[model samples]
Target: MRRNTGVFIAFAIVFCWFALLTFLLQFPTVFTEPWPYILLLLQTHLYTGLFITAHDAMHGVAAPGNIKLNTVIGFVCALLFAFNWYPRLLPKHHQHHHFVATEKDPDYHGGNFWAWYLSFLKQYITWPQMLAMALTFNILTYFFPLENVVLYWMLPAVLATFQLFYFGTYQPHKGEHNAENKHRSTTLKRNHVWAFISCYFFGYHYEHHDKPFLPWWKLYQEKDRSFK
Candidate 1:
Protein backbone atom coordinates (compact mmCIF):
# COMPACT_ATOMS: atom_id res chain seq x y z
CA MET A 1 0.00 0.00 0.00
CA ARG A 2 2.75 2.42 0.92
CA ARG A 3 4.72 1.64 -2.21
CA ASN A 4 1.66 1.96 -4.44
CA THR A 5 0.52 5.46 -3.43
CA GLY A 6 2.14 7.34 -6.30
CA VAL A 7 0.68 5.10 -8.96
CA PHE A 8 -2.81 5.39 -7.50
CA ILE A 9 -2.47 9.17 -7.22
CA ALA A 10 -1.20 9.46 -10.79
CA PHE A 11 -3.99 7.20 -12.01
CA ALA A 12 -6.69 9.20 -10.21
CA ILE A 13 -5.33 12.51 -11.45
CA VAL A 14 -5.37 11.45 -15.09
CA PHE A 15 -8.74 9.69 -14.91
CA CYS A 16 -10.43 12.45 -12.91
CA TRP A 17 -8.85 15.27 -14.89
CA PHE A 18 -10.05 13.83 -18.16
CA ALA A 19 -13.59 13.56 -16.89
CA LEU A 20 -13.54 16.96 -15.17
CA LEU A 21 -12.25 18.62 -18.33
CA THR A 22 -14.98 16.97 -20.35
CA PHE A 23 -17.63 18.19 -17.88
CA LEU A 24 -16.29 21.76 -17.92
CA LEU A 25 -16.49 21.91 -21.70
CA GLN A 26 -20.30 21.58 -21.63
CA PHE A 27 -20.89 25.24 -20.83
CA PRO A 28 -21.94 27.95 -23.25
CA THR A 29 -19.39 30.32 -24.88
CA VAL A 30 -16.57 28.03 -23.70
CA PHE A 31 -14.87 28.09 -27.08
CA THR A 32 -15.20 31.86 -27.46
CA GLU A 33 -13.01 32.38 -24.38
CA PRO A 34 -9.39 31.37 -23.68
CA TRP A 35 -10.58 28.75 -21.18
CA PRO A 36 -10.99 26.16 -23.88
CA TYR A 37 -7.43 26.65 -25.09
CA ILE A 38 -6.05 26.34 -21.56
CA LEU A 39 -8.21 23.30 -20.95
CA LEU A 40 -6.92 21.77 -24.17
CA LEU A 41 -3.37 21.92 -22.84
CA LEU A 42 -4.41 20.56 -19.44
CA GLN A 43 -6.28 17.73 -21.11
CA THR A 44 -3.29 17.04 -23.31
CA HIS A 45 -1.12 16.75 -20.20
CA LEU A 46 -3.54 14.24 -18.72
CA TYR A 47 -3.52 12.25 -21.94
CA THR A 48 0.26 12.04 -21.64
CA GLY A 49 -0.24 11.03 -18.03
CA LEU A 50 -2.35 8.13 -19.20
CA PHE A 51 0.44 6.82 -21.40
CA ILE A 52 3.10 7.42 -18.74
CA THR A 53 1.14 5.43 -16.20
CA ALA A 54 0.69 2.67 -18.74
CA HIS A 55 4.42 2.69 -19.43
CA ASP A 56 5.07 2.37 -15.70
CA ALA A 57 2.74 -0.60 -15.65
CA MET A 58 4.76 -2.11 -18.46
CA HIS A 59 7.74 -1.99 -16.11
CA GLY A 60 5.64 -3.50 -13.22
CA VAL A 61 5.50 -0.36 -11.07
CA ALA A 62 1.97 0.95 -11.56
CA ALA A 63 0.50 -1.28 -8.87
CA PRO A 64 3.46 -3.18 -7.50
CA GLY A 65 1.33 -5.07 -5.00
CA ASN A 66 -0.96 -6.83 -7.48
CA ILE A 67 -0.21 -7.89 -11.02
CA LYS A 68 -3.87 -8.14 -12.10
CA LEU A 69 -4.69 -4.68 -10.75
CA ASN A 70 -1.64 -3.23 -12.50
CA THR A 71 -2.57 -4.71 -15.88
CA VAL A 72 -6.21 -3.61 -15.62
CA ILE A 73 -5.22 -0.03 -14.87
CA GLY A 74 -2.75 0.01 -17.74
CA PHE A 75 -5.33 -1.40 -20.13
CA VAL A 76 -7.95 1.13 -19.07
CA CYS A 77 -5.45 3.98 -19.37
CA ALA A 78 -4.36 2.99 -22.88
CA LEU A 79 -7.92 2.47 -24.02
CA LEU A 80 -9.19 5.74 -22.56
CA PHE A 81 -6.36 7.86 -23.93
CA ALA A 82 -6.62 6.87 -27.62
CA PHE A 83 -8.13 3.42 -27.80
CA ASN A 84 -4.54 2.16 -27.68
CA TRP A 85 -4.22 -1.54 -26.98
CA TYR A 86 -1.96 -2.33 -24.07
CA PRO A 87 -1.14 -5.91 -25.06
CA ARG A 88 0.14 -4.78 -28.43
CA LEU A 89 2.24 -2.01 -26.90
CA LEU A 90 3.84 -4.21 -24.23
CA PRO A 91 5.97 -6.42 -26.45
CA LYS A 92 6.95 -3.60 -28.76
CA HIS A 93 8.11 -1.43 -25.87
CA HIS A 94 10.27 -4.20 -24.45
CA GLN A 95 11.64 -4.90 -27.90
CA HIS A 96 12.63 -1.25 -28.27
CA HIS A 97 14.44 -1.40 -24.96
CA HIS A 98 16.25 -4.59 -25.88
CA PHE A 99 17.43 -3.34 -29.25
CA VAL A 100 17.98 0.29 -28.24
CA ALA A 101 18.82 2.45 -31.29
CA THR A 102 19.50 -0.32 -33.74
CA GLU A 103 17.16 -1.15 -36.64
CA LYS A 104 15.70 -3.83 -34.35
CA ASP A 105 14.36 -1.05 -32.14
CA PRO A 106 10.89 -0.23 -33.40
CA ASP A 107 10.86 3.28 -31.87
CA TYR A 108 14.24 4.34 -33.27
CA HIS A 109 14.42 5.45 -36.89
CA GLY A 110 17.41 7.76 -36.48
CA GLY A 111 17.85 11.58 -36.76
CA ASN A 112 15.21 12.41 -39.34
CA PHE A 113 12.27 13.64 -37.29
CA TRP A 114 9.32 12.88 -39.55
CA ALA A 115 10.72 9.55 -40.68
CA TRP A 116 11.32 8.45 -37.09
CA TYR A 117 7.88 9.60 -36.03
CA LEU A 118 6.22 7.77 -38.89
CA SER A 119 8.11 4.58 -38.00
CA PHE A 120 7.14 4.98 -34.37
CA LEU A 121 3.49 5.35 -35.32
CA LYS A 122 3.58 2.37 -37.62
CA GLN A 123 4.52 0.06 -34.76
CA TYR A 124 1.63 1.21 -32.53
CA ILE A 125 -1.15 2.54 -34.76
CA THR A 126 -3.51 -0.06 -36.13
CA TRP A 127 -6.71 -0.26 -38.15
CA PRO A 128 -8.53 -1.31 -34.98
CA GLN A 129 -7.32 1.81 -33.18
CA MET A 130 -8.57 4.01 -35.98
CA LEU A 131 -11.90 2.22 -36.19
CA ALA A 132 -12.46 2.39 -32.45
CA MET A 133 -11.60 6.10 -32.39
CA ALA A 134 -13.90 6.78 -35.30
CA LEU A 135 -16.73 4.87 -33.62
CA THR A 136 -16.20 6.68 -30.32
CA PHE A 137 -16.15 10.08 -32.03
CA ASN A 138 -19.39 9.35 -33.84
CA ILE A 139 -21.06 8.01 -30.72
CA LEU A 140 -19.87 10.95 -28.64
CA THR A 141 -21.05 13.58 -31.13
CA TYR A 142 -24.63 12.31 -30.84
CA PHE A 143 -24.95 12.96 -27.08
CA PHE A 144 -22.33 15.65 -26.43
CA PRO A 145 -21.55 18.86 -28.28
CA LEU A 146 -19.40 17.94 -31.29
CA GLU A 147 -16.91 20.68 -30.49
CA ASN A 148 -16.52 19.47 -26.92
CA VAL A 149 -15.85 15.90 -27.99
CA VAL A 150 -13.48 16.94 -30.72
CA LEU A 151 -11.47 19.52 -28.76
CA TYR A 152 -11.35 18.02 -25.28
CA TRP A 153 -11.50 14.35 -26.18
CA MET A 154 -9.92 13.81 -29.59
CA LEU A 155 -7.48 16.66 -30.17
CA PRO A 156 -5.71 16.33 -26.83
CA ALA A 157 -5.04 12.62 -27.34
CA VAL A 158 -3.51 13.36 -30.73
CA LEU A 159 -1.25 16.05 -29.27
CA ALA A 160 -0.33 13.78 -26.37
CA THR A 161 1.04 11.18 -28.82
CA PHE A 162 3.41 13.77 -30.24
CA GLN A 163 4.34 14.80 -26.70
CA LEU A 164 5.19 11.19 -25.76
CA PHE A 165 7.03 10.58 -29.00
CA TYR A 166 9.11 13.77 -28.86
CA PHE A 167 10.23 13.90 -25.22
CA GLY A 168 10.09 10.22 -24.31
CA THR A 169 11.27 8.43 -27.45
CA TYR A 170 12.91 10.77 -29.99
CA GLN A 171 14.89 13.02 -27.67
CA PRO A 172 16.37 10.35 -25.41
CA HIS A 173 17.23 7.87 -28.15
CA LYS A 174 18.32 10.43 -30.75
CA GLY A 175 21.89 10.68 -32.11
CA GLU A 176 24.45 7.91 -31.57
CA HIS A 177 23.75 5.35 -28.87
CA ASN A 178 27.43 4.42 -29.00
CA ALA A 179 29.51 2.23 -26.68
CA GLU A 180 30.14 5.03 -24.15
CA ASN A 181 26.40 5.55 -23.83
CA LYS A 182 25.62 1.88 -23.21
CA HIS A 183 22.02 2.65 -22.37
CA ARG A 184 21.68 4.32 -25.77
CA SER A 185 19.66 7.07 -24.16
CA THR A 186 20.14 10.72 -23.10
CA THR A 187 19.32 12.61 -19.91
CA LEU A 188 18.04 16.15 -19.83
CA LYS A 189 19.68 18.80 -17.63
CA ARG A 190 18.35 18.91 -14.09
CA ASN A 191 14.95 20.56 -14.00
CA HIS A 192 12.49 18.41 -12.09
CA VAL A 193 9.60 20.76 -12.72
CA TRP A 194 10.25 21.06 -16.43
CA ALA A 195 10.86 17.31 -16.72
CA PHE A 196 7.49 16.48 -15.12
CA ILE A 197 5.57 19.05 -17.14
CA SER A 198 7.23 18.02 -20.38
CA CYS A 199 6.89 14.26 -20.22
CA TYR A 200 6.52 13.06 -16.64
CA PHE A 201 10.28 12.93 -15.98
CA PHE A 202 10.80 10.82 -19.07
CA GLY A 203 13.13 13.56 -20.34
CA TYR A 204 15.54 12.33 -17.66
CA HIS A 205 15.39 9.26 -19.80
CA TYR A 206 18.94 7.93 -19.49
CA GLU A 207 18.17 7.47 -15.81
CA HIS A 208 15.12 5.52 -16.89
CA HIS A 209 16.99 3.16 -19.25
CA ASP A 210 19.71 2.75 -16.62
CA LYS A 211 17.29 2.06 -13.78
CA PRO A 212 14.29 0.54 -15.46
CA PHE A 213 12.73 -0.39 -12.13
CA LEU A 214 12.26 3.20 -10.96
CA PRO A 215 8.82 4.58 -11.66
CA TRP A 216 8.43 7.66 -13.87
CA TRP A 217 7.94 9.94 -10.85
CA LYS A 218 11.27 8.74 -9.39
CA LEU A 219 13.42 9.20 -12.50
CA TYR A 220 14.27 12.82 -11.66
CA GLN A 221 15.72 11.83 -8.31
CA GLU A 222 17.75 9.13 -10.07
CA LYS A 223 18.89 11.76 -12.55
CA ASP A 224 20.12 14.05 -9.73
CA ARG A 225 21.73 11.26 -7.70
CA SER A 226 23.70 9.55 -10.44
CA PHE A 227 24.01 11.59 -13.62
CA LYS A 228 24.74 15.21 -12.49
Candidate 2:
Protein backbone atom coordinates (compact mmCIF):
# COMPACT_ATOMS: atom_id res chain seq x y z
CA MET A 1 0.00 0.00 0.00
CA ARG A 2 2.85 2.42 0.80
CA ARG A 3 4.57 1.77 -2.53
CA ASN A 4 1.28 2.07 -4.44
CA THR A 5 0.42 5.32 -2.68
CA GLY A 6 3.85 6.72 -3.47
CA VAL A 7 3.39 5.97 -7.16
CA PHE A 8 0.02 7.74 -7.11
CA ILE A 9 1.42 10.73 -5.21
CA ALA A 10 4.26 10.94 -7.73
CA PHE A 11 1.79 11.57 -10.55
CA ALA A 12 -0.36 13.81 -8.35
CA ILE A 13 2.56 16.08 -7.56
CA VAL A 14 3.35 16.52 -11.24
CA PHE A 15 -0.31 17.21 -12.06
CA CYS A 16 -0.69 19.74 -9.24
CA TRP A 17 2.29 21.72 -10.47
CA PHE A 18 0.81 22.08 -13.93
CA ALA A 19 -2.71 22.65 -12.62
CA LEU A 20 -1.50 25.43 -10.33
CA LEU A 21 0.55 27.00 -13.08
CA THR A 22 -2.33 26.98 -15.50
CA PHE A 23 -4.42 29.02 -13.08
CA LEU A 24 -1.70 31.30 -11.68
CA LEU A 25 0.01 32.08 -14.98
CA GLN A 26 -2.97 34.20 -15.94
CA PHE A 27 -4.09 35.17 -12.48
CA PRO A 28 -5.46 38.71 -12.31
CA THR A 29 -3.89 41.39 -10.09
CA VAL A 30 -0.87 39.28 -9.16
CA PHE A 31 1.46 42.01 -7.93
CA THR A 32 -1.24 44.33 -6.61
CA GLU A 33 -2.03 42.44 -3.43
CA PRO A 34 -0.42 40.61 -0.48
CA TRP A 35 -2.42 37.47 -1.29
CA PRO A 36 -0.39 36.94 -4.44
CA TYR A 37 2.75 36.70 -2.32
CA ILE A 38 1.14 33.73 -0.60
CA LEU A 39 0.46 32.28 -4.02
CA LEU A 40 4.14 32.69 -4.90
CA LEU A 41 5.20 30.82 -1.77
CA LEU A 42 2.70 28.07 -2.48
CA GLN A 43 3.96 27.74 -6.05
CA THR A 44 7.53 27.59 -4.82
CA HIS A 45 6.53 24.76 -2.51
CA LEU A 46 4.95 22.83 -5.36
CA TYR A 47 8.14 23.36 -7.34
CA THR A 48 10.10 21.72 -4.53
CA GLY A 49 7.54 18.93 -4.59
CA LEU A 50 8.55 18.32 -8.19
CA PHE A 51 12.17 17.71 -7.24
CA ILE A 52 11.26 15.62 -4.21
CA THR A 53 9.13 13.37 -6.39
CA ALA A 54 11.98 13.01 -8.83
CA HIS A 55 14.31 12.15 -5.98
CA ASP A 56 11.91 9.38 -4.95
CA ALA A 57 11.88 8.13 -8.51
CA MET A 58 15.65 7.88 -8.35
CA HIS A 59 15.25 5.71 -5.26
CA GLY A 60 12.66 3.55 -7.09
CA VAL A 61 10.01 4.46 -4.52
CA ALA A 62 7.94 6.67 -6.76
CA ALA A 63 6.94 3.73 -8.96
CA PRO A 64 8.53 0.71 -7.34
CA GLY A 65 7.97 -2.05 -9.84
CA ASN A 66 7.68 -0.16 -13.13
CA ILE A 67 11.04 1.09 -14.29
CA LYS A 68 9.88 2.86 -17.45
CA LEU A 69 6.90 4.54 -15.82
CA ASN A 70 9.06 5.59 -12.89
CA THR A 71 11.71 7.18 -15.09
CA VAL A 72 9.08 8.89 -17.22
CA ILE A 73 7.47 10.51 -14.18
CA GLY A 74 10.88 11.68 -12.96
CA PHE A 75 11.86 12.94 -16.41
CA VAL A 76 8.67 14.98 -16.72
CA CYS A 77 8.93 16.44 -13.23
CA ALA A 78 12.58 17.43 -13.66
CA LEU A 79 12.04 18.79 -17.15
CA LEU A 80 9.22 21.04 -15.98
CA PHE A 81 11.25 22.19 -12.98
CA ALA A 82 13.58 24.42 -14.97
CA PHE A 83 14.39 21.71 -17.46
CA ASN A 84 16.53 19.69 -15.05
CA TRP A 85 17.68 16.43 -16.66
CA TYR A 86 16.74 13.34 -14.63
CA PRO A 87 19.41 11.05 -16.11
CA ARG A 88 22.16 13.38 -14.90
CA LEU A 89 20.70 13.65 -11.38
CA LEU A 90 20.54 9.85 -10.86
CA PRO A 91 24.22 9.03 -10.41
CA LYS A 92 25.11 12.15 -8.44
CA HIS A 93 22.34 11.45 -5.94
CA HIS A 94 23.56 7.89 -5.39
CA GLN A 95 27.12 9.20 -5.08
CA HIS A 96 25.91 11.54 -2.33
CA HIS A 97 24.34 8.55 -0.58
CA HIS A 98 27.44 6.38 -0.94
CA PHE A 99 29.92 9.05 0.13
CA VAL A 100 27.70 11.05 2.52
CA ALA A 101 29.74 14.11 3.54
CA THR A 102 33.01 13.02 1.93
CA GLU A 103 34.68 14.64 -1.07
CA LYS A 104 32.88 12.20 -3.36
CA ASP A 105 29.48 13.59 -2.29
CA PRO A 106 28.33 15.93 -5.05
CA ASP A 107 25.89 17.64 -2.68
CA TYR A 108 28.45 18.49 -0.02
CA HIS A 109 30.85 21.45 0.33
CA GLY A 110 31.84 21.56 3.95
CA GLY A 111 29.83 23.86 6.25
CA ASN A 112 29.69 27.11 4.32
CA PHE A 113 26.18 27.86 3.08
CA TRP A 114 27.12 29.89 0.01
CA ALA A 115 29.90 27.53 -1.00
CA TRP A 116 27.78 24.43 -0.59
CA TYR A 117 24.86 25.91 -2.51
CA LEU A 118 27.09 26.91 -5.39
CA SER A 119 28.56 23.42 -5.45
CA PHE A 120 25.08 21.91 -5.42
CA LEU A 121 24.02 24.06 -8.35
CA LYS A 122 27.17 23.25 -10.28
CA GLN A 123 26.66 19.55 -9.73
CA TYR A 124 23.19 19.67 -11.29
CA ILE A 125 22.97 22.63 -13.65
CA THR A 126 24.07 22.25 -17.25
CA TRP A 127 24.15 24.54 -20.29
CA PRO A 128 21.58 22.49 -22.14
CA GLN A 129 19.23 22.75 -19.20
CA MET A 130 19.68 26.51 -19.12
CA LEU A 131 19.12 26.76 -22.84
CA ALA A 132 15.98 24.67 -22.69
CA MET A 133 14.60 26.85 -19.90
CA ALA A 134 15.37 29.99 -21.84
CA LEU A 135 13.65 28.69 -24.91
CA THR A 136 10.60 27.62 -22.90
CA PHE A 137 10.41 30.99 -21.17
CA ASN A 138 10.53 32.79 -24.50
CA ILE A 139 7.81 30.56 -25.92
CA LEU A 140 5.58 31.00 -22.87
CA THR A 141 5.75 34.78 -23.21
CA TYR A 142 3.90 34.52 -26.52
CA PHE A 143 0.95 32.85 -24.78
CA PHE A 144 0.97 34.26 -21.25
CA PRO A 145 1.38 37.65 -19.69
CA LEU A 146 5.05 38.36 -19.08
CA GLU A 147 4.31 39.49 -15.53
CA ASN A 148 2.42 36.31 -14.72
CA VAL A 149 5.07 34.06 -16.27
CA VAL A 150 7.86 35.87 -14.45
CA LEU A 151 6.08 35.90 -11.11
CA TYR A 152 4.13 32.65 -11.07
CA TRP A 153 6.40 30.49 -13.19
CA MET A 154 9.99 31.68 -13.08
CA LEU A 155 10.46 33.30 -9.67
CA PRO A 156 9.04 30.39 -7.64
CA ALA A 157 11.32 27.92 -9.42
CA VAL A 158 14.38 30.03 -8.52
CA LEU A 159 13.25 30.33 -4.90
CA ALA A 160 12.55 26.60 -4.69
CA THR A 161 16.19 25.83 -5.49
CA PHE A 162 17.17 27.77 -2.39
CA GLN A 163 14.36 26.12 -0.43
CA LEU A 164 15.43 22.63 -1.47
CA PHE A 165 19.11 23.40 -0.94
CA TYR A 166 18.77 24.98 2.47
CA PHE A 167 16.44 22.43 4.02
CA GLY A 168 17.21 19.21 2.16
CA THR A 169 20.96 19.42 1.61
CA TYR A 170 22.64 22.20 3.61
CA GLN A 171 21.08 21.70 7.05
CA PRO A 172 21.14 17.91 6.89
CA HIS A 173 24.74 17.45 5.73
CA LYS A 174 26.61 20.55 6.83
CA GLY A 175 29.06 20.71 9.77
CA GLU A 176 30.75 17.95 11.74
CA HIS A 177 29.04 14.74 12.69
CA ASN A 178 29.32 13.12 16.13
CA ALA A 179 31.43 9.94 16.48
CA GLU A 180 28.42 7.63 16.33
CA ASN A 181 26.77 9.46 13.43
CA LYS A 182 27.42 6.71 10.95
CA HIS A 183 25.79 8.37 7.97
CA ARG A 184 27.38 11.74 8.76
CA SER A 185 23.90 13.16 8.50
CA THR A 186 21.61 15.09 10.86
CA THR A 187 17.90 14.67 11.42
CA LEU A 188 15.84 17.71 12.30
CA LYS A 189 14.23 17.94 15.72
CA ARG A 190 10.73 16.49 15.52
CA ASN A 191 8.22 18.83 13.92
CA HIS A 192 6.22 16.90 11.38
CA VAL A 193 4.35 19.91 9.99
CA TRP A 194 7.46 22.01 9.52
CA ALA A 195 9.32 18.99 8.19
CA PHE A 196 6.77 18.56 5.42
CA ILE A 197 6.46 22.30 4.77
CA SER A 198 10.22 22.67 4.78
CA CYS A 199 11.21 19.89 2.38
CA TYR A 200 8.67 17.11 2.27
CA PHE A 201 10.16 15.74 5.52
CA PHE A 202 13.60 15.61 3.97
CA GLY A 203 14.82 17.24 7.17
CA TYR A 204 14.29 13.79 8.65
CA HIS A 205 17.41 13.16 6.68
CA TYR A 206 19.36 10.80 8.91
CA GLU A 207 16.45 8.41 8.65
CA HIS A 208 16.71 8.84 4.91
CA HIS A 209 20.41 7.94 4.77
CA ASP A 210 19.51 4.96 6.92
CA LYS A 211 16.67 3.87 4.64
CA PRO A 212 17.09 5.28 1.14
CA PHE A 213 14.40 3.15 -0.40
CA LEU A 214 11.59 4.88 1.47
CA PRO A 215 9.77 7.69 -0.36
CA TRP A 216 9.90 11.26 0.90
CA TRP A 217 6.35 11.02 2.26
CA LYS A 218 7.40 8.12 4.49
CA LEU A 219 10.39 9.88 6.08
CA TYR A 220 8.26 11.12 8.95
CA GLN A 221 7.23 7.58 9.81
CA GLU A 222 10.86 6.51 9.83
CA LYS A 223 11.73 9.52 11.91
CA ASP A 224 9.25 8.30 14.52
CA ARG A 225 9.89 4.55 14.23
CA SER A 226 10.46 2.50 17.38
CA PHE A 227 13.50 0.35 17.98
CA LYS A 228 13.99 -2.78 20.09
Could you estimate the TM-score for every candidate?
0.94, 0.95
Backbone clashes, each candidate:
0, 0
- Candidate 2, residue 12: the lDDT equals 85
Model 1, range 1-228, lDDT digits (tens) per residue?
Answer: 778785676668666766776685574435568988887888889889988988888988888878898898889888887889999889988998899888898888965999989988888899989999999889888988888888888888889999999999999888876688988898889998999999999999888988888888788889889855
Whole-model lDDT values for every prediction: 0.85, 0.88
lDDT of 2 at 71: 91
RMSD each, Å: 1.5, 1.5
Give the range where candidate 2 is weakest over 10 consecutive residues by summed lDDT. 219-228
